[model samples]
Target: MESKSKKQKMSALEQLKKFTVVVADTGDFEAMKLYKPTDATTNPSLMLSAAKLERYHYLIKEAVEHANKVATTTDEKITEAVDLLSVLFGREILNIVPGRVSTEIDARLSFDVDKSVKKALKIINLYEERGINKDRILIKLAATWEGIQAAKILEQKHNVHCNLTLMFSMVQAVACAEAGVTLISPFVGRILDWHVANTKASYDSTNDPGVISVSNIYNYYKKFNYNTVVMGASFRNIGEVKALAGCDLLTISPSLLEELENDTETITQKLNESEAKQTNIDKINIDESTFRWMLNEDAMATEKLSEGIRKFAADMVKLEVVVEDFIQILGK
Candidate 1:
């Protein structure tokens, strides 16, 4: 007999298709298979956590072995290991997801325009050599001004798509859209995290600053008809996900995806262009200096942006160590 759970699950997928593109923001293949999200996103931090798991230990070992063969220096070995680990994860995710999988560049390259672009192209080239088409991958980069410029060049010259990460402000969003990047991941949970830490104030979804930030960006994008896709990322809870139901896309963590799957409740659309066009928002362009200055002025954005980069970079280093240890164990 058909189960009630099956019926409800079908209904949820039907409903989800109406409003947003659901993305699985995880490195766990088991979870992603169950959720059946359109795309998958991963960062060094998530990859590091996944590496510690027994199920994913093979990735570490494989990366280490691959690194040992070609690396002439310690730094080269580390970078090679990271790239291998990222590609392994990306390949696994691509097997499950029908759409793109975002593989992030090293966060340490966030502020270095040339290095970030070079690394991004390298990741794409690695994937292509493995028979993965460039269309199936989006190179993720920190949405610093430098990163945006790099994305611009990548888009124009190499025909590579980009997923701009760590975006915090309207300025950043506008800049990305203007640059002709493919996608933008505006962090919802991280913004809330900053607000809570800075103000010592509690916030509900309706009034949450993070919620407002995403909504504003969505509205702006829809208003101007930018081709860049807005994928709301780093959600804290199911509430944030439900609140932004009509966003172009939302990259949700495994726990939150589980929560949404378990609940049989309804999700309503909260954002659309008609409503966005009704608002009176003044649009402005910012140069590099002004963009940085504006970012610095927003205490929450300034702090969280720096903190996010450091956290991702530290995790990348830890992941490098794990890969190195695995290589040593394998006698590679």
Candidate 2:
């Protein structure tokens, strides 16, 4: 009996869960119900994909009607409606998962700190009105300079937790930690995407840029005693996901989640607080200039950050168009 129990405990998914929080990266509430992740994250792209499914079409209608009740102008109505839609999807995912839901603001607002803060607060209010606790939400922002700045204020003053996303550089991670944000999502797959495109080379998990990116951030945070959680995002394959087994959190796609569940290979811990503390690294201050300079020096980070923002912004526009068409059909 004891030997059987020990063998069962050796499953990769179970062992990985022992140290890190698992978050589902999609907006699909039904799938989340099955996988039972500790948290869920949604961006415009994910929400748009979910809204297209006939099962979730009602959420789109509900958001439009909900927005029309508050705003007067056509533009205002569309804007408010999109915000409501983001919250509505988040609310549904929250119901399935036992933990917080991270809903992103518009990617176009990534550079406008003030606008991002206002948008984040409004989303919080929308969720609150729906009877969800504030603590059960994280307003995901881009890891741009402005976005990081806005998150600091939102965390310090408004008591709103922030997840700095689209992070591809160590400098960005350092800045986010300094800002005292709730979490930082270092995109592992996107980092891999950039390297593959430029070098046209394949990499195993050991040397994968994506895996190395998250690992560096994770080690740095632990070494410096930062409270910000590091969540590895945008994994391209099971190897990329498995490489980051001991990350603070890893938001994975539903497809990848299934891979983890089926695999019984032993998952070993590669990172821990004690291990991080023993490694010596220089802690440096990153003001705006240093942050910008460091990012410029790294080609992968520079290209990937811009590319990520553009892709998300494009998806945001597409989602708005969908909402616009839906509203036009309503003839309001």
Alpha-carbon TM-score of each model against the true structure: 0.94, 0.95
Candidate 1 clash pair list: none
Per-residue lDDT of model 2, residues 22-114, tens digit only: 999998887798778899998988988987888988988999897778888878878988999998898888878889999998999989999
Please state the error at residue 206 of candidate 2 in Å. Answer: 0.8
Q: What overall lDDT goes with each candidate model?
A: 0.86, 0.89
Clashing pairs in 2: none
RMSD of 1: 2.2
Worst 10 residues of 1 by lDDT: 8-17
Model 2 segments more than 4 A misplaced: 1-11
Model 1 lDDT tens row, 187-239: 99999988888789999899878789999998888777789988999989888
- Error in Å for residue 269 of model 1: 1.1
Q: Residue 228 of candidate 2: its Cα lDDT?
A: 98
lDDT of 1: 0.86
